[model samples]
Target: MAEVAILGGGCFWCTEAVYLEVKGVTKVESGYTGGAQPNPTYEQVCTGETGHAEVVRLEFDPAQISYRDLLVIFFTIHDPTTLNRQGNDVGTQYRSVIFYETPEQEATARQVIAEMAHVWDAPIVTELAPAAPFYKAEDYHQNYFAQHPLQGYCAFVVAPKVAKFRKTYADKLKT
Candidate 1:
């Protein structure tokens, strides 16, 4: 069976690119979540007024890659210590968060955060929240990193994260 995990680690472009290479992640949909708006456009979210975080909703085979493993990669790929921001992107929409679909996933997320605390000098600020309405991003946003690898933002920001994931989790990457 496939399990769902919605995570916000800075930009959905980076998160989507990383998970798309993971061995067990079957689908990664870049979207907006944890927001009040029924359908938020990227522009609205970018303005930081939608209460939504740019998130990637992933479907993965637990047997191949546990939710805990996903959390580990997520925390490493992005800085969770910075609240409402990641690097140059400063906004609530870029906050580090995990919207778990199941109790097990929630527990695992917390456990992973706890276990990873010592690795960073700052306290982890990643939010643990129940899954909310996920508004899929515009068609152009889907597979954005793959589709726009040479684009300035993708090359300067997304590419480095993808490279880190590949170097750090080579065994878990797709063949």
Candidate 2:
């Protein structure tokens, strides 16, 4: 069965690009969640008024890759210690967060957070919240990094993260 995991680790493009290459991840969709505005637009979220974070919802085969493993990859790729920012991306929309769907997922998230605490010098500030309504981002946002690998932001920001994932989790990548 395919299990769901919603994660906001900076920009969805960065997170989505990395997970797309994971062997067990069946699907990755860039979207927005944890906000009040229904079906928020990228422009709206970028303004940071919607309270939504750019997130990627992943469907993965747990038998192939455990949930804990996914969280570990997530924590490694992004700066979880910084509040409401990632690199040059600022505001609440760029915050690092995990919207867990079940009690098991919640527990795993908390456990992962604690373990990640030892890896970083500063305290991890990633939000572990209950899964909220997820609004799919615009069609253009889906598979953005793959489609725009040469684009400025994708080249400078997203590509480096993907490269890091490729190097660190080379065995976990799809054939």
Candidate 3:
């Protein structure tokens, strides 16, 4: 059976690019969640007034890759210790968060955070909350990295994260 995991590690472009390469990840959509707005535009979310975090909603086969594995990859690819920021991107919309879809998912998120804490020098500031209504990002943001690899942000920011993911999870890459 397939399961969904809504995670926000930073810019959805970077996270989406990383998950798209994972073996069991069947689909990855860049979107907005943990917000108050009904349907927010990129500009609104950017203003940080929408209270949304740019997130990636992943559809994956759990039998092939456990949620724990996904969480591990997520934690590795971004800095969870920093609040409302990821490298050059800084704002509430870029906050680190995990919006769990179920109680089991919530438990796993907590466990993963606890285990991953030892690896980070600072306390993990990643928020764990019940999954909220996901507002799919506009067409342009869907596959930003793949569609615009040569774009400055994609080339400089997203590419490095994807490279690290490939190097660290070589065996898990889709063949």
Candidate 4:
């Protein structure tokens, strides 16, 4: 069975783009979670009033890629030290967070964050919370980087993250 990981490390587009290249990730969907709203639209989430963070729902084969490895990749691809922001994208919706579905997931997330803390110069501000309702983003938000690779945001913001992942984790990339 495929295990799921919900992560919000700034824009979902950046996270989705990098994970899509991982060897065991079967699917990546951009969404909103960790919020009060039941089904927030992208615009609503973008407003930062929804209390939701833009997150990516990833389905991965654990036999091929451990959840720990996925978390490692996630931490590396984004700046978790910056609270409520990633690069120029700033807002509560862009905050770094991990919505774990189980006790085991929560423990793993904690361990990863602790381990990652030493790597960063500043404290790891990534939030660790229990899984909540995940509202799928609009149709246009899905596979955004792939569909609009040449778009300004994708070309500039998301592309570098994908490139860094490919370079840093070449063995984890799909053949």
TM-score of each predicted structure versus truth = 0.99, 0.99, 0.99, 0.98
Clashes of each: 0, 0, 0, 0
Model 2 alpha-carbon drift over 4 Å, by segment: none
lDDT of 1 by residue, 1-175 (tens): 9989999999999999999999999999999999898899999999999999999999999999999899999988999999999999999999999998989888898899999899999999999999999999999999999899999999999999999999999999999
Query: Comparing candidate 2 with candidate 4, which one achieves the higher lDDT?
Result: 2
Error of 3 at 38 (Å): 0.2
Name the better of 1 and 4 by lDDT. Answer: 1
What would the per-residue lDDT of candidate 4 be over residues 50-163, giving only the tens digit for each residue?
A: 999999999999999999999999999999999999999999999999999889999999999999989999999999999999999999999899999999999999999999
Which residue pairs show backbone clashes in model 2?
Answer: none
lDDT of 2 at 134: 95
Evaluate model 3: give its lDDT.
0.97
By summed lDDT, which 10 consecutive residues of candidate 2 come out lowest?
Answer: 141-150
Instruction: State the lDDT of candidate 2 residue by residue for 1-175, as single tens digits.
Output: 9999999999999999999999899999999999999989999999999999999999999999999999999998999999999999999999999999999999999999999999999999999899999999999999999899999999999999999999999999999
Compared with the true structure, all predictions reach lDDT values of 0.96, 0.96, 0.97, 0.95
Error of 4 at 123 (Å): 0.5
Off by over 4 Å in 4: none
* Residue 60 lDDT (model 3): 98
